[model samples]
Target chain A: MRCAKRNTILLLALLLTFAAWTSAQDEAPYYQSADFNVPIIAGWQNQSANEAAQFHKPAASATIRAAMATGADAEAAAAADLASWLGLAELTAPVYRGKVNLADGTWHVLARDIDAQRSVSQVARQAGDRFIVISFLESDPSSRIVMLAIAQADETLETAEPEMDSALEQLTGLRLDNLTAAQARALPGGEWLVYQSETALVAGSLFGNDSYIALQEGTAGDLAALADAWRGTLLGFFITPDNSPYLWLGITVSLLILAALAGSFAWRARALQKDLAMIEQLEKADAR
Target chain B: MTQHEAENPLAVRPQPRLLRALTIVSALGFAGTLVLGLFVAGTDIQQGQVQRIFYIHMPSFFGAFTAFGATVLGGIIYLWRGSEAWDRIALAGVEVGLAFALINLLTGSIWARPIWNTWWTWDPRLTSAAVMCLTYAAYLMLRAGIENPQRRRSLMSVYGIFAFISVLLTLFIIRIVPDTIHPVIVGASPQNAQGAFEATSGVVVALLPSLLLWLTLMPITLMWHRYRLALRQEAVDALKLKLLGA
Candidate 1:
C-alpha cells in the first residue's frame, strides 16, 4: 500500500510539470493596435505607446527601433503615421533592398542590406493598417537569419508603393546607431522615451495613436537575443509616455503664432507707409 | 542735432557711431559664437553629435531672459515716470524677447527629435515657455489695437509686468517641481541622465562669454532698431494729425 501511494504522487508531479511547459510555450507576448497586432514570442519586448516610439534592449548592442501609433483625431493620426514612415524610410534608404509584394496581398515587403556590412539587414513592410519594420544589427561576423513575425486580427496591405519610394528617397543617410538613452530623456516636447540602455534606447509616447505591436527575436548575441530579453521583461514592466503633452500640442500652436506675428508686422508697416504718403499729399495741397 | 530732432522730439535719430561700432563688435561676437559652438566644442561622448544643440539652445534662453528682464524694468520705470522713451524701450524688449524665445524653442525641438525620439513634449519648462511666448504675442496685438497713445503705453506697461511671471516660472519650475522628467543641465550631479551631457572645460570656457555677449548684443541691436522704427512712426502720426488740421 505504501509503494502504491508513492507511485501515485510521482505520476501527479509529472502531469503538473507537463502542464506548466505547455502553458509557457503557448504564451505569446503582443502589442495591439487599432487594425492589427504584432505578436512576439516568449523573449521579445513590448515597448509601445508613443505618437512615435523607439524600443531598445538594454542587453543588446546599439540599434534603432521606431514605430508610430494610430488612434487619434484623423489629422494627428495621419501626422503620427507619416512620422513613423519617414523614420523607417530614412533608416533604410542607404541600404535599400528590392521591394516585393508578398503572396498574402495584404503585406508588402521592402528588403535592404548595408553595403560591405554583411551583418546589417532591414525589412520594412506594411501589414494591415500598421507599418511594420524589422532591422538587424550585428557588427560581429554572423549571418544568422532572424525572423520577426506578426499575428493580427485583420491583416491587409494595399497600393502605396510609389509615394513611399519617393518619400524614401528624401531619407538620405540617417545613422541609426548614434542615439543614446540619456539624450532621449532630455528632449523637450510631449514625447517620451520608454526605455534606455548603454547600447539601446526606446522612446515614444505611451498614449500615442494606439498602433500595433512589434516583436524582436533571433539567435543569441545578435539583435534577436536582445529582443527576446526585452520580451521576457514586458509582463513585469508598466510604462508611460515620458514627454509632456504640451510640447506636442505646442508645435502647431506656435506655428500659428509666428504666422500671426508676421502678418501683424506687415499690416502695421503698410498702414504706416500709407498714412505717411497721405500726410505728404495733404501738406503739399495746403502749401499750394 | 538734425532739424527734425530739434523741431519734433519724437524724430527718428541716427545711432551714435560708438553704438554702431559696438553693434559691429556684437555681430562679430555672434559670428564667433557660431564658430566656437559648432566647431570648437568637443563632441559629447554619451549623446554624440546631437549634443551640439545645447551650445546655441542655452544661450537663446539667456537672450530671452535678458530681453524679458529689460521689459520688466522698462515697465516699472514707464509706470513710475510716464516717459514715452521707456514705453518704446519696453515694446522693443518684447519683440527681441519673442525672437530669442523662438530660437530657444526651435533648437530644443531639433535636439529632442534624435534624443527623445519625438519632436516635442509639453514638459514643465517647455509649457512655461509657450505661455510666455503667447502672453507677449498678445501684448503686441494689444498695442496694435489701441488708438490712444497714452492708454496703449500704460496698458502695455502693466501687461509687460504681469507677463514676466511666466518667464520666472519657466526658469524655476524645473528646479522647484519634482514632476518634470526634464533633467537639470546646469547643476546636475554625476548620476546618469538621458538627454544630459557634460560640457568639457573647453566647451564651458567657450560657451559662457559667448552666451553673455549673445544676450547683451541681441537686445541692444534689436531694441535700437525697433526704437528707431517707433520714433519714426510717432513722427508720422503727428504729421498726419497736423495735416488733418490744415
Candidate 2:
C-alpha cells in the first residue's frame, strides 16, 4: 500500500509538471536575433534572420531594418551597410549628416536619396568591435518625406523646440515663425510638439536629449504614426548581453567537484581491497 | 556462507538490484536534464547564456537540502535505536551534503560575478549559507578527532542534529534580514535588479526535471555508495586490529 501511494504521488507530480510545461508560454514577447533583440512591430510583417531584424509595412511602402555591420566608424559602417543593403556599387553623399549622444552611445544620423524612387534615413552607432545601424527606407516614389534625428542645443529646454525650429527651416524650406503656434500632442513614444504650415507639416518628439523630427513635403501622410513606430523600434531595440564565459566556468567547477567526490569513493574502495588482501596473507602466515 | 562472511556479517556483499537500477536511472536522468538546461532553454537577452547556470544552481541547493535532511533523519534514528549502521548513514550524509553545498556555493558565486558584478558578498543569505557549509565541515573534523567508537557516534549524532539549524537559518535568513540581493525562488522577484530570472516555459521544463533529479536521485545514489564504502571500512578496520593484536 505504501509503495502504491508513493507511485501515485510520483505520477501526480509528473502530470502536473507536464501540464505546466504544455500550457506555459513558449515564445518571448520580442523578436530575438543573434546580435540584438527588438520588439515585434504589431502590424508589420516580420522578415528577420541572422544578425538583422526587418519589418515591412506594405501599406506605407516603408521598411525598417536594424542590423549589425562592421567598418571603421559609425559613418563608414552606415555607408557600407547601405551599399550592401540596396546593392549599389557607388552612392552619392548624404544630404544631411549629424551626430547625437544618447543613453547608449553617440549615434551618427544621416539622410540620403538612394535614387529617384528610393530614399533612406539611417542612424548608426559603434557597439564593441562593430556598428549597429537602423535604417528607415521609403520605397514610395510619391512620398517626399524626410526624417532626421537632431541633438538638443541646450540641456535646460523642456522640449526639442530649438532642434524642431532648425529641422523645419532646413527640411521644410520654411522658418519656424512661418508656422502657427506649437501644439502639444501626446503620442506613444512621448509627448511631441507639432508645427504646421500651408504646404508642409513637421513634428518633433523629445527623447534622451535629442529630437527625432519628421517633415512631410505635403500634409497627406501619417507622420505621427510613422514617428510612433520609429520610437517604439528605437526604444525597444537592445544588444543581448553575452555572459557565456561565466556559464562555462560555472559548469566546469560543478563537474570537477562532482568528479572529485566520485573519485574519492573509488579510491576508498580500492584501498579497502588492498587491506583485505593483506589480511588474508596474514592469516595464511599464521596458519603456516 | 563463507567462514569470513559468517564471522563478520559486515563483509562485502553483491550490489542490490534496486540500488543498481537506481544508479542507472540517476546517470541517465542527469544527462537528459543537462541537455534540457543547456540546449532546450532560451538564452536570456538581458543576462545572455550565463543565465543557464540557474538550472543547476537552484537544483544543487535542493540536493544539499535533501542530503542534510537525511543526516538529520539518520541521527535521530541512530540515537533512538543505538544502531551503528544508522550512524554510518549519518556520516555518509555529511560527506555527500558537504560536496553538494560546495557545488552550490561555487556555481552561485560564478554566476553572481557576471550578474551581480561581484564574486562574493556579505549578504545575509550568502553569509548564512557559508556558515552552514562550514558548520557541517567542522562536524567531519570533530568526528575524526574522537577515538572511542560509541562516544564518537553519540557526540557526532548530537552535532548533526544541531547543525541542521544552520541549514534552517540559510533557508530563512532572506526573510529575516530582507536586505539580501540573493533571489527568493518562489512567490516573488529577486531583490537584485540586474539578476532578473524570467521563468519562461522552456526554462521551467528544463529546471523541473533537473530539480527533481538532483533533489531525489543524485543525493540518494551518492549516499548509498558512500554508505556501502563505510561498511567496508568498518570490516577492514576490524581485520587490521586482529592482525595487529597477534
Best by DockQ: 2
lDDT of each: 0.54, 0.83
For A1-288, candidate 2 gives per-residue lDDT tens digits of 999999999996887577456645566667887778888887888988766888888887888889889899887898898899889998888888998877667888888888878788888998899999988888887766667888788967878778877877776568878887777778767887778776777788888777888776643466766766776787688887788899999999988998899899999899887778778877888889
Q: What are the C-alpha RMSDs, in order, of all predicted structures?
A: 23.2, 4.6
RMSD of 2: 4.6
Error of 1 at B181 (Å): 2.8
Chain B alone, TM-score, model 1:
0.92
**Candidate 2 iRMS, in Å?**
2.6
Error of 1 at B245 (Å): 2.5
Clashing pairs in 2: none
Question: DockQ (C-alpha) of model 1?
Answer: 0.05
DockQ of each: 0.05, 0.57
iRMS values in order, in angstroms?
17.0, 2.6
Best by TM-score: 2
Write one digit per residue (lDDT tens) for candidate 2, span B125-236.
7898899999999999999999999999999999999999998998888777778788776667456534766676667778888999999999999999999999988998
